[model samples]
Target: MLKSMTGFGSATQEANGLTVTAEVKTLNSKFLDIYCRLPRVYSDKEVELRNLLTQRLERGKVELSLNVTRLTDIRPGVTVNRPLVEAYVNDLRNTSQSLLLDVSDSDLFKLALQQPNAFNSEVSTASETAASDWEHIQLTALEAIRKCDEFRQQEGHGLESKFREYIQIIADRLTLIEVQDVKRIPAVRERVRNLVTELMGSDEFDQNRFEQELIYYIEKFDISEEKVRLKNHLSYFLEVLAAEEANGKKLNFIAQEIGREINTIGSKANDASIQRLVVQMKDELEKIKEQTLNVI
Candidate 1:
């Protein structure tokens, strides 16, 4: 089945008191190009994530981002060092006594608490938290990838339908060209015969040489070979479009072949009617080329 390169997906999950979200977006590209935005803790996993995307999506310009938020408190903000506070308080009390000054018990306690090393603002270790949450983040990313694939499938279906319509229009125009070709041949012959008679006096013209030259001239403008080749190219295009594997490059190459055949027919067809039909085929082929860029 065909798939489009343009799509978007995201997934969010909660684990280990953290909320994690994974988002992915893709666009058409000749090769797989990945851009990653990750939290500092998961920086080491960027290579693994890129490999996963490459294996799944194959070819595209891909952008992935991982976001995290704390959902619950994992540690206290601060903790007091009881022994350090007591030591400071004892030293302060001794100094007050030697100076013959009395200090309130509450004041001494307050002064000790204010001393450096008495308490510490807590900082949770990220290594441990990241190790525990990695699994959840990976699973969320897989889910997002699946959703993006589904989006590609839907867009591809629409493109396929359009392609079928455009191909049919070109086929219809080819038929018109065939019909006009038959009428064009008789008119061309009559005009060429009259010109030959006018250029060379009828009595003086050599009949054998004239016949040979006329045959050669008519063969040069004959579109029968071009018509057959064009028909084959059109059939091949439809066959590839129906294949099980989605090969955008192959399909694009076939389209170029189809255009080549159409151009050959246009240039060889001396009739105005055939030229008009060729113009219509060219228009439809251009549309097909434009839409194929988004295919995968």
Candidate 2:
């Protein structure tokens, strides 16, 4: 089954006064490469997210992002250290008296409390509401991933159909090449006889030597073996396409082999008719190669 490597999906949810949104994007790649942008609270979940993506998408560059927002009333309020504020106030008043720096002042106490570190707090901690909020976030994220996978599958189906059509085109061209090849034997034999007659010129050529030399020349240019291997490669290519596996790279390699064989046949064929047929066959195979780029 062929699957294209481009798709998108997103899911969002709000519950327990927290909002979570997730989106995933995929692009063509030789291997599964997953990247993530996640909230600090959910950073620990990156590995699980990667695994989930790898399991669903056999190969691609994937990006998954999770964003979390806290509602105002549910957030953790600020913290103030009353003991520390009091100590600062006492120390400042004593220092002022010892140094005779400042006159008595009630407003000074308020100024001391306003200093830095007098208060500290994490504004986003969920505390009692953390689990419920996390649950909603997780559910939404999973839904988004599922939708993305569905999109990939549908796109894959379209690519699969195209691959099948290209494979058929290659098979049909192979038939033409085989037919042309069969006609080549008779043509080569006739040409060999004429060449012998011309070269002998008034003296009969030795039949045994002529036969041996002719055999050697024909064997040197024969493309029968290459054609046989190409046909076999095409058959296996179709077989792998039918199987439920990640066979994109394997199919590409097979396609290279097919191209190699076609090249050998093109170069070896010397007849004008066969050369024209080879051109047509090459055109068809090139189309297959172009379409194979989308396989995943």
Per-model TM values vs. the true structure: 0.78, 0.74
Stretches of candidate 2 off by over 4 Å are 77-128, 197-212
As for candidate 2, its clashing pairs are none
Clashing pairs in 1: none
lDDT of 1 by residue, 119-186 (tens): 96655655455567787888999888888989998998888888889989988999999898888889
**Which candidate has the highest lDDT of all?**
1
Put down candidate 2 lDDT per residue, 1-296, tens digits, no spaces: 56677888999888766788999998887778889999887888788778877777777888998989877665336777678887878887888889988745576577677888887675455454666676787788788888888888788787777777777777787788788878888887787788778767747668787788778768756888987898898888888888888466887888888888877888887767767766776776677676566567
Write down the lDDT that model 2 would get.
Answer: 0.78
In terms of TM-score, the best-performing candidate is 1
Error of 1 at 271 (Å): 1.2
For model 1, the superposed segments whose C-alpha errors exceed 4 Å read 75-129, 195-212
